[model samples]
Target: MGNNKSLRDMQAEVDQYISQFKEGYFSPLAMLARLSEELGELSREVNHFYGEKPKKSSEKENTVEEELADMLFVVICFANSLNIDLQKAHDAVMHKFNTRDKDRWTRIGEEGEDENGNN
Candidate 1:
């Protein structure tokens, strides 16, 4: 959560995570499917939030948060298997945008506009 760590560090953490699993309980394809299911759950929350779909009757249930965490867990597990540092990957994309497309998505604060100011 603080900063990028080496692949070795990520690998060690992944090894510890795998230690808790029973042998051959799941496969890569299964993990991907699980990830997809989590994404679908998250999408439902987005739909409800945007009024494109009705909110569930169990409003107290935090399905969205749980789904998001589920998606992240699988994503990190996938990246760990592929020997990718999620933080490093994230930073690389951010750097690319900062260097190459800094102005591609201009916003009011930078555009010298209060065009839609909510004040």
Candidate 2:
């Protein structure tokens, strides 16, 4: 963890990087495809590290953290291209989870509740 940066900062950084290129950001469809590709890479890394799937000796070495960062970069680019504020989107998602999904799960050290709202 180097210097902590906000989502806005990350978005700006990506925008600046894309600005230098003649072809700024990819189209939404292309970005989505790229996102899916990154996701697949991340999933493969996770499977190699945690799941039963093991990497072959000839395969190139990679870490889950690196794959996650790659995914984040693509996500930031996608968000920036759409002019969507990730921080605001995150806040809204958090709000929904906090309110609508509150009590949806059991708390540690506390008795679990059933769907009927029983103890």
Candidate 3:
């Protein structure tokens, strides 16, 4: 079964998987380091695609999607270790953005739109 799991399901799955291991989850500091490393990998991929840096001939090909998934896996592990529900966290952040930044940016109709209302 793929592509059917929600954020909580994914967290539970990761927790279950890690439960089988003797070591379980890494320490919080170690998890943070792993997250940083994964982020760096993503940044490197982005730099290769959009920045001046070029990938070495010997470097293996990596996609942004793959790196993002890797990062998400680590994030799931972190959240599982801390008993944090990512869905709730996501909702809280969304709420904050919706309320706090609601008027932060200019609305499309505010400045007026093009002939077809395509601003």
Minimum summed lDDT over a 10-residue window in model 2 is located at 108-117
Output the better candidate (1/2) by TM-score: 2
Per-residue accuracy of model 1 over 1-119 as CA lDDT, tens digit each: 23685545655666587768776224678878878888887888777776577876976555667878677767777777666777788889989999888666756565654435443
Off by more than 4 A, model 2: 113-119
Of candidate 3, the 10-residue stretch with the lowest lDDT total is 109-118
lDDT of 2 by residue, 1-119 (tens): 23788998888888999999999999999999999999999999999999999999999999999999999999999999999999999999999999999877787755766766577
Backbone clashes (count) for model 3: 0
- Best TM-score goes to which candidate? 2
Give Cα-based local distance difference scores for all models.
0.70, 0.93, 0.92
Order of all candidates by TM-score, from best down to worst?
2, 3, 1
Q: How far off is model 1, as Cα RMSD?
A: 6.0
- Name the candidate, 2 or 3, with the larger TM-score value: 2
RMSD of 3: 3.9
Q: lDDT winner among the candidates?
A: 2
Sort the predicted structures by lDDT, highest score first: 2, 3, 1
